[model samples]
Target: MAERRTIVSGSTFEEQIGYARAVVDGDHVHVSGTTGFDYATMTIADDVVDQAEQCLRNITAALTEAGCTAADVVRVRYYFPDRADFEPCWPSFRRYFAGARPAATMLVCGLADPRMKLEIEVDARRPG
Candidate 1:
């Protein structure tokens, strides 16, 4: 059997919610939906665009730890409470996913925190 490992971002939510920020199973890495909070300070930007940028920062960290990069991502999921917030985030999203062109989905839905404007999740595969 392949080894399965967990990646932690030291978010209180992980301990409270009982979930890892990401998990690695062999060559595959599954990153949990990450919000805009900067884990270091536990602070989130008020603007959705800023939050979107932070979301990518958080996701990138997990991907790097998993021996991957944004280019290695194969699938992505974006969550936002407001559909209007989506269009404004395109530039931020494109900054990471432009040429990589990973499969993607965006959904409008409620989030755990009212302050959270966006969440991003990704799946990546390490090349053989």
Candidate 2:
């Protein structure tokens, strides 16, 4: 049987949220929606672009912990509270995703927390 692993970053909220950083099933890794809040500082950045960048950072950390890298990402979903915020952060997003360029979706949505302007979710695969 394939192993099931739960990725946790030692954050209490992770348990509260009832989700893991990533779950590995066979060759696939499914990462949950990650926010821009810095888990270390427990704070969210003020700027939308900065928050977006931080969201990617959090996603990267989660992926790394799951024995994967940005290059392995096959799909990405980005949630933004405001569509206008996307323009300013497009460059940063492109810079980070230049190599992977996973199938992506960007949308404007009301997030769980008011302080959270952006959230990122990803799916990755380990090469056979």
Candidate 3:
């Protein structure tokens, strides 16, 4: 049987929502949509760019715990409440994903929390 594991960031949202932050199944890691709230203090930034960077930090932590890095990412999705907020975060995205250059998409949509300017989800494969 293929090995499977779950990685948690200790965000109350994960327990409240009943979902793991990331799941390691065989060679693939599927990270759940993660927000900008620092799982430690549960505080989020007011600026969209700052929120975008925090979202990457949150996702990177989950990926690390799952035995993969952003460089291993194969796909990524960005969700934003405002399309205008997306451009301001491009530099942050480029910094994190320049190497992986993972397939990417951005969507404008509502989030669970109005304070959440952006959410990010990623899929990665462990180097074989």
Candidate 4:
């Protein structure tokens, strides 16, 4: 069996919700839907674009911990509470994902916290 490991981001939500920020199984890494809250401060930005940028930052940290990088990401999913907020975040998303060019999808849906404007999830493969 491939060894599976969990990566914690020190967010209280992880403990309260009973989930890891990311999980690594063999060569694959799956990052959970990450919001804009900075785990250190537990605070989130009000702007969707800012939240999107922060989400990528958090995802990047998890990927790095899993021995991967944005370049290794093969798939990505974006969740937004409001459809109108999605386009405002495109530049931020494009900045992080242009190189990877991963398969991507965006959905307009509700989030756990009303303050959260967006959430991002990604799947990556550890490089050879």
- Which residue segments of model 3 deviate by more than 4 Å? none
Over 4 Å off in model 4, which ranges?
none
Superposed model 2: Cα runs more than 4 Å off: none
lDDT minimum window of 10 residues, candidate 2: 4-13
User: Lowest-lDDT window of 10 residues in candidate 4?
Assistant: 86-95
Write the residue-wise lDDT of candidate 1 on 1-128 in tens digits: 99799999989999999999999999999999999999999999999999999889999999999989999999999998999999999999998998689999999999999999999999999778
Encode model 2's per-residue lDDT on 1-128: one tens digit a residue.
98778887655578797877778887899988888888888888889888888888888888887788888999988888888887888898888777898999998999888988788889999766
Clashes of 4: 0
TM-score of each: 0.97, 0.92, 0.98, 0.97
Q: Candidate 1 vs candidate 2: which has greater TM-score? A: 1
lDDT by residue (tens digit), candidate 4, 1-128: 98799999999999998999999999999999999999999999988888888888999999999999999999999999899998888888888989999999999899999999999999999998
Question: Candidate 3, residues 46-127: lDDT per residue as tens digits?
Answer: 9998888889999989998888888999999999989999999999999999999999999999999999999999999999
Which residue pairs collide, candidate 2?
none
lDDT, model 2, position 16: 90
Q: Candidate 1 at residue 35, lDDT?
A: 98
